[model samples]
Target: MNLFRHAAFEISVASPDGLPFSPAPEVAFAGRSNAGKSSAINTLAGHTRLAYVSKTPGRTQLINLFRLKNGAALVDLPGYGYAEVPAAVRRQWQGLLEHYLTRRENLVGLVLIMDARRPFTDLDRKMVAWFGTTGKPIHCLLTKADKLTNQEQIKVLRDAKAEAASLVGNITLQLFSSLKKKGIEEVEKIVGGWLNPEIRGEAS
Candidate 1:
């Protein structure tokens, strides 16, 4: 069975105080606006609209949570790096992301989404550095792999792995394509291990 297919919407938190209390583990999905973050999430959940796919960037303004069947949760953070969004709103989102990533005890790992053609932008690196401080694992998805050629995919994967090696903490990278439905199992295996450590012994 697909572990993430049973995911269902739980809540959307606009402020730190509104964050829910849960005993189950959580995995956060974060990326720049329009970087295919929502699409990747919906693909993983095996639902068309599990996470909203918007043509406009910065549409995911709140911290959204989705509950899995086993009690574990998936967190869809507000996308960053959209210039058109008001500066005040961007600052608020930044605060929310920092607070949750650093302070949430139930958070097990992070699934960082990046466009295959443009992996590891300055903002993405900042996110890695922020979450790396927690010493948790991060699995990066280079989304929109379908947009790249076969050779381009291999080159990007190679370069991304090399770049990720310089980042702090345990990080893994893979090419993903929501249009192609690729790399879903890889994400599931990594995230599932974090949510159920006993089953896999530990997160890689």
Candidate 2:
């Protein structure tokens, strides 16, 4: 089943205190602004506009949560590393991301989205290293794979996997394309396992 298909907007929290209590585990989707983070979520949920896709980066300043049919939640974190955003707003976003990733008890794992052509930027590396301290699993999705040639895709995937090996925590990498609807099942299976560990345990 497409686990994220049933995702519906729950709430948008601008501050840490505004975060709601969720009984189910949450999987956060985070990345640099313009990395196709919202597009990935919309594609995974099988919706055109579940997560707003804006032409302007840094538009998503709040943490948006979407509840799945199974009660699990998909957290859309504010995009980072936008030059146009004010320094104060960027600091606020950093604090919010740090707090949620490090302190959220119900967070199961993270789904880090990146452009396939450029897998990891300086900010992305910082995010990985910092979040790695949590010892939680991180599944890196190299989105916009369709933009690359087949050979380029293979090379990027290989290089990304190699690079992830040096990152802390349980890191997994995969190529994805929101435009082509590629890597949907692969992500569903991986993320579903995290949301519902019971099923994963049973399968194992």
Candidate 3:
């Protein structure tokens, strides 16, 4: 079954304590501010307004949860690396992220998004490191891939894969373009495995 198609907004959490005690495994989508994380979620959902795409970076300050009909969930974490926000707020976000990544028992994996033109910024590396310690799966989606040439895209993909090889956990990556709807099925298939009862166990 198409799990993403069954997705619906569940909650928006600003604090770690706001996270619900869900038994279903969660797949968290994360990225730098303006890296098309929300757009990627909407595209995967096959719904235009499923996730709010904002022009201003750092606008998504809450951890938005989308529940699937099967009970599994997709989590949209607040984007990092935008400095216009207050320093204290950034620190708070850091703490909230750390707490959720390490303490959320239902979280099964992470889907980190990055711009294809500039993959693996400092904050991205830090996020990868933080989650890698848990030894969970991490799949990076290189968004805005349509902006780059085919050759450029391949090079970025190769480099990103090579970098993932050195991370602590099972880190994989692929080229994705929300604008062009590229790799939508492949991503959905993978994420679907995590949400499907009969197949989620095999996903790990």
Residue-wise lDDT of candidate 3 within 1-204, one digit each (tens)? Answer: 456775899899888689889787899999999999999999888889888999999999999999877778899999998999999999998998888888898888899999998899999999999999987778889999999999999899999999888778878789999889898877877766555666656654
The 0-to-1 C-alpha lDDT of every candidate, in the order given, reads 0.92, 0.91, 0.87
Candidate 2 lDDT tens digits, 1-204: 879997999899898678888667899999999999999999999999999999999999999999999888999999999998999989989999999999998888899999998888999998998789987789999999999999999999999998889878789989999999999999998887887768634643
Q: Which candidate is the best by lDDT?
A: 1
Candidate rank order under TM-score: 1, 2, 3
lDDT of 2 at 119: 86
- Model 1 C-alpha lDDT per residue in residues 97-124, reported as the tens digit of each score: 9999999988989999999999999999
Off by over 4 Å in 3: 196-204
TM-score of 3: 0.94
Better of 1 and 2 by lDDT: 1
How should the candidates be ordered by lDDT, best one leading? 1, 2, 3
- Model 2 accuracy (lDDT, Cα): 0.91
CA deviation > 4 Å runs, candidate 2: 199-204
**TM-score head-to-head 1 vs 2, winner:** 1
TM-score of each candidate?
0.96, 0.95, 0.94
Better of 2 and 3 by lDDT: 2
Q: Which 10 residues in a row give candidate 3 its minimum summed lDDT? A: 195-204
Worst 10 residues of 1 by lDDT: 195-204
